[model samples]
Target: MSFAALGLVPPPTFCKKRGIEGFRSHLSLCGVVVGDLVSTSVPRPPGPVPSMTPASRRGLISWAELDFRAYVFGAIRNERNEFTDAFIKQLRLRPDKFVVVSRSETDAGQWLELFGGDQDETFYQMRSRMFEAPMASFNNRPVGHGAWDNIRMGRDVLYSTGQAGEMDITGYLRKLETERNEGWLFWLKKDRFKVKYLLILDAQPNRSGIQLIQDVAWAAMCAAGYVRGAYSIQKYVKATDALLQAKITERLSWLPPSYALTFPVSNHHNALLKARYARYQA
Candidate 1:
């Protein structure tokens, strides 16, 4: 039903404004559009809001503003030759743009200190800016459980940035491919609309030398091995087991599968294996 038909009028405070335009600007600041105000009786609930366009937000962090230490930490990993090469070139091109945060300085305080605070504030309210997500602290345990431990910690650290509208496309994509197929829906059912910025965390330490390098060279070798065609099932089982061990598939429903920020491309396989599988299907 129309709000006018329901016997409602603009609030007296709204009428107090100079004109409709002033009231509309105030409504927009409160997450409401002037047109929406007329069509709907209910008001939008108050909460955090997006303040920038996708392009403008993305522009804020050029390669130069990226943390250098984490880049080095990630670049040394297997299969990361491309990233390492790119980062090294950027570092040489503009060393002044780099932000250095050491291992001991990974805490919330260090981040605030390095990034600075607001005009009237003495500190960068890290907690105030933190984005809360469900999977942030999913599998908490001591750090001795190998790759799983690393993933758990990584998820937790990344969750803290959700308030900034960081979207994890890779995680969301994986959910569509794997988990949702098995009835694990409703992962990002609520916050999907609120997501504005992509979540691309700097490489963390738990994954430095663990992932195998599977570039074109490795794909060629695998293809040659698969041509022999013996024990193909056994090899497939082993690969599956390794993937399970890595605990590297997208577990977070909020993430999409496009970005490879924290983990290697989980769906990659050697060319030989692909050919053998296709032939077996035939």
Candidate 2:
């Protein structure tokens, strides 16, 4: 199913214009950047507009925690669109399992509490429990310093090996438990819980953001039953007149059929003037 099937559509303001080019033009006014050659073959589903609801209240059931950072960069480098397809397909198949999160949710404190370690458990203890959990019930447990340090050290050594490589080091580390590796043993207790999926949203479209997403994805994958799809939506901002420049410089390898929002940037002086004028009117 397409986004249209999920009740997404261009706003009514843009609906008055005909065809894809018109849609793109309208999107620019809102600061959304769409690839010039977007495919329009996908059909929009017909229905009355639904009432708006807060994302946090959506009550979507996620099996795993998705790292938005990784999902966006992965999509950028996804020349073949495979990554995009994997993401969208999951949404179509299990829309109820995904919830959109904002950039604020990426805060270290919140992430640590949710996925890493908080007051309740150490990072190693959390990892050990998650590894032991079953697929259907996997979720982030507490993370503490010792467990995280052990995993990080193993990852560093694997990367340093060059031959063993850093790629898929999380998966490799999971394998270490089978080998009874001294360092990993502490966090490899027999447990049955595991994480199923992670859905992250509003991640910044930058290198650091990409690393964050990758790190989250890797952490989830390290557990057993690593599912194929983790979806994310990255937010991009641009000045009103810089649409063309953005289109040229920021080439998305696979432009998935999705809604875009364009927030026009204004000079600081102009913004201040407008704010003052609004206050004066009030």
Candidate 3:
């Protein structure tokens, strides 16, 4: 039913409850990080509010003023190539245009650097000056061919950017050419399932972005492997198999599947799953 149809009115305050759950997630997407000290425009509709865009109630404070340590910390594992090579590169070119650097020679083991920190006050003052918002971090590059291409990565190659070429396309096309020259994909029964999968968290519900920030940080921690073995509930439950069902439900229902952080939703979970996967293991 329409909110207005029922004569519902909004609160005096505005910009507090615009989006449903993706608010903090959007901040992460925008690359705002821990301790960056920025403000969020959480709009609270005056009356029966209508839909709004992200820019509607541009926050009085800019999140750029806050710290970004935790988000960078969460990126450690993905940067180390533990998650997926593609993911490592994709992060470099995120839309938020966050700046990252590799502290060591190992893969993408770099931390984030916000450009606004130096002039945080200015960033907040210029909130309305969207067009000229100076970046507050390093590597102020744009997305290009691969992963880090968009962001300002020192490297400028497709491989480093996480981009692909005709060969990649050709390989995908060739996968369709069956041995019989048929235009269908064919795989052994064993190949139908993945050997393993990684669950990563994105945005979350509730909070003034603090809770979401912490949750995202924790998820990133798992993604970065700082909280090693956290990706697998089985590993933790091996010591004691209590509250297994509840844990699984809470995790799945909490976030979107696309951003659903998982604990190795293994086929070995319960008796039914075990029975179905037992023969395959043997």
lDDT of each: 0.26, 0.26, 0.27
lDDT of 2 by residue, 1-282 (tens): 012111234322322223333323323322222221211122332111222332233342212221111121011111224443443343334322222221122234323112222234221210110112122322333221122222222123212233343433332223433655544322322233221112232122112322333333322222212333342211011221243234323443244424222322222322333455567558
Query: What's the CA error at residue 62 for candidate 1, in Å?
Result: 36
Query: Which candidate should be chosen as best, given lDDT against the real structure?
Result: 3
Q: Which segments of candidate 2 are over 4 A away from where they belong? A: 1-147, 150-161, 164-237, 240-282
Query: Model 1 shows how many backbone clashes?
Result: 15
Q: Which structure is stronger by TM-score: 2 or 3?
A: 3
Q: Pick the candidate with the highest TM-score.
A: 3
lDDT of 3 at 149: 14
Q: All candidates' TM-scores? A: 0.15, 0.16, 0.20
**What are the per-residue Cα lDDT tens digits for candidate 1 across 1-282?**
112111133432322322332222222222222221111112332222332223224323111001111111111111234433443333233223222221111233322212211233221111112122222121331122111111122232222333334332232323334543354322322333321111122222212111111111112223323222233534643443343223234232244645322433222223335555778778
Question: Poorest 10 consecutive residues of model 1 by lDDT?
Answer: 62-71
Order candidates by lDDT, high to low: 3, 2, 1
| TM-score: model 3 vs. ground truth | 0.20
How many clashes show up per model? Answer: 15, 32, 45
Better of 1 and 3 by lDDT: 3
Candidate 3: lDDT over CA atoms?
0.27
